[model samples]
Target chain A: MSAEIEDLLKRYQNYPNVVGIIILDPFAIPIKTTMEYTLTVHYAALISTLTSKAAKMVTNLDASNELMNIRLRTKVHEVIVLPSENYIIIVVQNPGS
Target chain B: MSAEIEDLLKRYQNYPNVVGIIILDPFAIPIKTTMEYTLTVHYAALISTLTSKAAKMVTNLDASNELMNIRLRTKVHEVIVLPSENYIIIVVQNPGS
Candidate 1:
């Protein structure tokens, strides 16, 4: 799993405009992050909570539907979150770059 | 204020893909919604939480930056949240429609 994560990190880091990547456990604890420790932990916690809330919203609207992903765009960056059963991946990028 | 909300609702309802619109107070309480009552309340609570968490994440990354919007895409719909100082507007749309 560690090897796979390392490979994933390298691949995403090579992408254009990619700024940072964070891989978190099911509990939203950062397992691997290319960003500074403080910022990484902050993002891990908040993004996981956001993802869960979104999933709940989806389920409430339709019991059979599922949440695919979330794209949060701020003035400076675009944060994309992918939530799977095992882990959640957050990628922060500068879209204008 | 009520008249403005009614106009906003009417305008968004005429948009190409918009399915429902929800206007919420700063507290995430629904002020006006085109959706059913139960669904409106559900969306108001969860989306407000999502917006706040995302905003916090933005500020954490860069104290000077601000969160502009959030686009949450599920299998069936796209939920767009616009948060302002006084109100939050949520639009649920079928993008593939």
Candidate 2:
């Protein structure tokens, strides 16, 4: 699983603006990270909470649909969140290409 | 304000995959929408709640940082949330190029 995740991160690294990537468990425990700094457990947990809540929000509105990815962009950075069955991948990037 | 929002929506419409746009007050009241279907008040409120929670989470970790935008993509659609001082704009789009 780790090797597969590393490969996935490598692919994302090729995309424009991508700077860092972090993979986490459902509980928000860090699985692997390509970030310069280690991600804090508290931050990971909060990110997981946000993803779960957003997924729930969608589910409540349309039972047939499921969430696949989330992206947040600020002036300085962009963050993408991808949630799967048991894992969540977060990619951080520069705002523009 | 409405005219300004309409202009903004028009600009986003030119972006790839963009299908709809909705602008709402901080209270989640619909200010304007360009979607085919009218968005329910409940849905807007839930979106606002999620944004607030996410922003708070960020603040707890880094006091100086503020959330500017959030985007979510599914197999069929993508959602972007942009929060400002008094309003939140959500853009819906098809996934992929």
Candidate 3:
């Protein structure tokens, strides 16, 4: 299993144009890392996946600055982004069943 | 939502003795960050969760260099630990259904 994990990490490390990549659990902890990942982007990705999925499964995504977000706060660990940017933030919920 | 994420990050950061904390997706990406997480330990957390779950659901976690591991390769990203060390590696499989 450890050998397999090494191989998997190498494969993801070679992602094209990647800067940093990280792997964590639902609570937002490190699982893996690559060039395409960083402290900032890692959280963004988790949030993005969680929020996006949660919106569909729990609520909905918003666009306007003053709009409602999904009910993913509980299911997800939480992620923060820039103050005034249109960068995508996605979140995915892991059903513990 | 953004504010909520910030609060969550701060709360986790305050974890006693936490070196760093990162949140990522199954693809081995990041979602959030804290103090008690690192590149190696983060991966360990993911692997630990994944392999543990996979072992129970697919196979089981072994404790020998020349032993068999679970069948979590497909559902998990991958994680590696020192060959000579018995550090825990957890992996969690997210059922796509």
Candidate 4:
């Protein structure tokens, strides 16, 4: 699983627009990150919190519904969050670049 | 201010794919909602939390950066969150429709 996660991170890192990628645990702690330690930890904490809240929001809206992804567009970046079983993956991209 | 907000809500409600719209205060409490009471409150709480967190994430990533918008795509809905100084506007749409 670790090797697979490493491969996944490398794949995302090599994407044309991708600037950073972080894999986080259920507790929102970064397991792997292409960014600096401080930045990755910050992202892990904030993005994961939002993701869980989003998942809950979906479930409460309709029992059958499920959260797929959150795409946050900022003035300088685009952040994509993908939540899986054991870890959550977050990617920061330069959409205009 | 309220009348302007009402007009804004009405305009959004008239959009092509919009299903529901909600306005939330800074505290994540619903000011007005096109959806039912329970659903609106739920959205207000969850979406506003995500929006503010996202904004902070952007600011922390770079002092010059600012959050523009968040688009959360779920299996059954596309939620667009717009955060402003006084209020946050959330719109749920069915992109497939």
In candidate 4 the C-alpha lDDT for residue B61 amounts to 70
TM-score of chain B of 1: 0.93
Better model by TM-score, 1 or 4? 1
Number of clashing pairs, model 3?
57
lDDT tens digits, residue span A33-81, model 1: 9999999988887888878988987898789889988988888888888
* Model 3's TM-score against the true structure: 0.23
Clashing pairs in 4: none
Tell me which of candidates 1 and 4 scores higher on DockQ: 4
- Overlapping backbone residue pairs in candidate 2 total 1
List model 1 lDDT by residue over B34-82, tens digit each.
Answer: 8999989888877887788788878976899999889888988888888
lDDT of 4 by residue, B39-61 (tens): 88778877776787778878977
lDDT tens digits, residues B26-94, model 2? Answer: 777888877544454555777889889878876765677778888777666788888998788887888
After superposing candidate 3 on the true structure, give the runs of residues whose Cα lies further than 4 Å from its correct spot.
A35-97, B1-97
DockQ (0 to 1) for model 3: 0.02
Q: Give the per-residue lDDT of model 4 (tens digit) for A30-76.
A: 88888998888778877887899878878887899898988889988
The C-alpha RMSD in Å for every predicted model, in order, reads 2.5, 2.6, 19.3, 2.8
Candidate 2 pairs with clashing backbones: A71-B71
lDDT of model 2 at position B12: 79
lDDT (tens digit, per residue) of candidate 2 on A12-74: 889787877788887788888776443546557778999999999888767887888877665
For each candidate, the alpha-carbon lDDT, in order, equals 0.87, 0.78, 0.34, 0.86
